[model samples]
Target: MTNDELQQLAAGLANCGKALLRMADVLMEKKEDAPAAAEQKEPEKKLTLEDVRRVAADKARQGHMEEVRQLIQKFGADKLSGVDAARYPAMMKELEAMGNDE
Candidate 1:
């Protein structure tokens, strides 16, 4: 190939590499910022029935099942799995309060 043709190809490749680098920087920036944005935008998630049971079992393991049972009774739940999803947060909060009391 002519010298001029080779130079033109090299220049094109350099520009492409620069573009790829810019794109990489943009992507890396998003990845870096995503966690902070998520930390800010993600509200505390509502707990599920499984979450309630896990916490209850944790309490049970800690010899606090009586307190957990009391909370279940207050919620009209026969067992941790019986508690409504909507009330899981309240149950977890009460459990946390119970934990703090100990």
Candidate 2:
């Protein structure tokens, strides 16, 4: 409403803008230096299902029979009634097909 009041308001706004610009400059500087300032890191190696299968097969072929048995016990078998009698051969066939595919 008054010239002095408007000038005071403008001065306040200018101070806020300067503060925001300084904060932005500091943030930009940190971002620019972040990668080099931190460790040059290696990308992590991810183990896939195929990697696991290959490792298990290798271990099995090397006579890690108990390891193979444990893996089969852990993740291979479907938990169902009469699974051993009902699905064992089919499972064997599926495994054989998988081996053939490989």
Candidate 3:
């Protein structure tokens, strides 16, 4: 890539990183401010199966399964040990079914 093209790509990445950081900050603030948030949450009881399914589906729709799998592999199943990895069979099935759907 030309220097100008590389510079533009770098700038775009920086902007994206900044946006992600802003989102993280907002999440942190909410967690700190909401004392009852944890108690009121049902996911705490069993972890949100729907959220996991949605995340897998979203990643599949976005053609990012490889990235998602890589993240899981890197993080290890133990990292999310509370979650039942067996339940993800459906997510993977859905992801496979969505191959090239995008």
The candidate that achieves the highest lDDT relative to the unseen native structure: 1
TM-score (C-alpha) between model 1 and the true structure: 0.56
Q: Looking at candidate 3, what is the lDDT of residue 33?
A: 80
Question: Which of the predicted structures, 1 or 2, would earn the higher lDDT when compared with the native?
Answer: 1
Q: What is the alpha-carbon lDDT for the whole of candidate 2?
A: 0.60
> When superposed on Cα atoms, how far off is each prediction in RMSD?
4.3, 12.7, 22.2
lDDT of 3 at 87: 52
Return the TM-score for each candidate structure: 0.56, 0.41, 0.35
Backbone collision tally, model 1: 0
Q: Rank the candidates by lDDT, best first.
A: 1, 3, 2
Q: Score each candidate by Cα lDDT.
A: 0.84, 0.60, 0.64
Residue 60 error, candidate 2, Å? 4.2
Quickly count the clashes in candidate 2.
0
Kindly report which residue stretches of model 2 are placed more than 4 angstroms away from their true locations once superposed: 42-102
lDDT for position 71 in model 1: 86
Per-residue lDDT of 1-102 in model 1, one digit per residue for the tens? Answer: 999999999999999999999999999999999998878866777777777788788888888888888889899878777777888888888887777765
Q: lDDT of model 1 at residue 62? A: 88
Model 2 per-residue lDDT at 79: 33
Q: How many residue pairs of model 3 clash at the backbone?
A: 0
